[model samples]
Target: MPETSLVTARERAVALLGGEPDDATLRRYLHGIPGVDAVGLEQRAAGLGTRSIKTSSKAWALDRIISLIDLTTLEGADTPGKVRSLVAKAVNPDPADATTPRVAAVCVYGDMVPYAVEALGDAHGDPDAGGVSVAAVATAFPSGRASLEIKLADTAEAVAAGADEIDMVIDRGAFLAGRYGLVFDQIAAVKQACLRPDGTSASLKVILETGELVTYDNVRRASWLSILAGGDFIKTSTGKVQPAATLPVTLLMLEVVRDWHLLTGQRIGVKPAGGIRASKDAVKYLVTVAETVGEEWLQPHLFRFGASSLLNDVLLQRQKLRTGHYSGADYVTID
Candidate 1:
């Protein structure tokens, strides 16, 4: 939707709710959601993934994938040096190919946000400014087990350190146990925590840990819950789960986003994290996003890929597309 006719996000959300956010209303609305048809959903996803892109579109898709990457590093062994290296690659993905597009952001741990911000230097603004953003995983990421106060503190510190985005994990345990209100409250709180002293808030990407959600119905519910709680993006996983991201799950989430846009005229973002390691697979996701949402959603704001090794594969494929043959392993740096 265009920016001019759009109402405030808060106004749209309130209109959707019909009243203030509370446990009873949340439960009634979520439970009232239509159940997913697993068989039909899987078939639709399969069909979309099988649609092949022509050679002309493949080149564009490769570059789009590069721009949508979050360039993530969330391991325990992460260091300031590693983050700087990651930021360097994010800024100039292919040193030999200056034309290669830079990635969207460098995602790091909360404590490492400062180093990422520092390393990004002048090239650390919006993608439109020819700069890559610094995204941080906060609120006890990948495992939302911390208290509400701790989660807010985690979010605040990252925002203070200058993270452009916050990828927070929702408490799946609460969601699973039918404590929908608890999960709702926590996500809303974390969204508030992302607010900066300067009045602008960091974008909030609510991680559903979809693998743990187990059912497509839960994925749908959680997607709606996160959006209702003011998440700028609804993410799939934490990269620590068995099934990090899959076409079917991502397609389902996109469907929710599509529906929300239909009702509110506001478009939310979606990030499919983990297990997307190949350029070809990434192309399939691009196709999914375009077909499901629209061609415009291929941009950095509406969609993102939480990836570590995906960039290398994309860079290699990019070289092949330009040079007409696959490049050697040494061409792209290995993470």
Candidate 2:
């Protein structure tokens, strides 16, 4: 907390919380940082989502950006009715707005993948008929406080159940306790368990629970660690806590992703989960990806929103443009 030792305090805080600070801790530190007032975080968010670069390779990057938008929702105990309702809303979307880019995947918890897969079959009638990939939250969700054997089994089950991607949370307690190598190995083992039926692997999104990790520095460090350990995507939160995904934390992640891409030449993804509720907020995130990571990450593969109530607003905005008037709120269901 000392001015001359902010850096040291940050290191100590990261150490105190175990090697990986969760979102709650990270947000506290972010708010406590001198000169990073509420407005500063918002300003940082505004700036991080708006950069675009023109290059001879711009067209190629644009295609990559288009592929990175994952529209996600992982409710605690979804039923077939709920899955049907969600799938209907996702696939039909706004008939008046059929041309908008579809999300990369529909993320749900493990129990719902079968329902999702069935719904996709009923509606779209083909493996890829549904407009999104089936992403599952596995390996001891919200709280990564499970044993390794159970965690690996969870990962294997989800992939076997047809999850195209796996979002696994790191064991915060261990990471915060300076067991960096252990956390890294945990991620590696889980990633290995997410292999596809063809022996290829499902893409792995390691949720740092940035809020828990507690600092931009740790978030950055975790970003590098996850990538080094083979994370296909570095997500911001589990949507389990108060500060589950905020603009400032996301900017830090994007900056890390951008730099990592440069250093490793291996493209990684970014997903900001929790508390995003409006189309404007979604666009703000898109803007942040474009500006900070460049246009390369604008797509769902590189970018996504882990939200339950966001799609309605996106549909609302799209419908407003089509009908020249706002539809009654009662008509919206993705909420």
TM-score leader = 1
Which window of 10 residues has the lowest lDDT sum in candidate 1?
Answer: 1-10
**TM-score of candidate 1 to 2 decimals:** 0.93
lDDT of 2 at 28: 51
Candidate 1 segments whose C-alpha is farther than 4 A from its true place: 1-14, 326-335
Indicate which candidate wins on lDDT.
1
Task: Residues 164-222, candidate 1: write the lDDT tens digits.
Answer: 89999999998998887788778777777877766677888999999999999999999
Give lDDT tens digits, candidate 2, residues 135-246. 8898889898899999999888887887778899988887676666677668777877876656566778899998888766667667766665668888888888767888
Alpha-carbon RMSD to native, per candidate: 4.2, 9.8
lDDT score of model 1? Answer: 0.86
Reference-based TM-score of each model = 0.93, 0.76
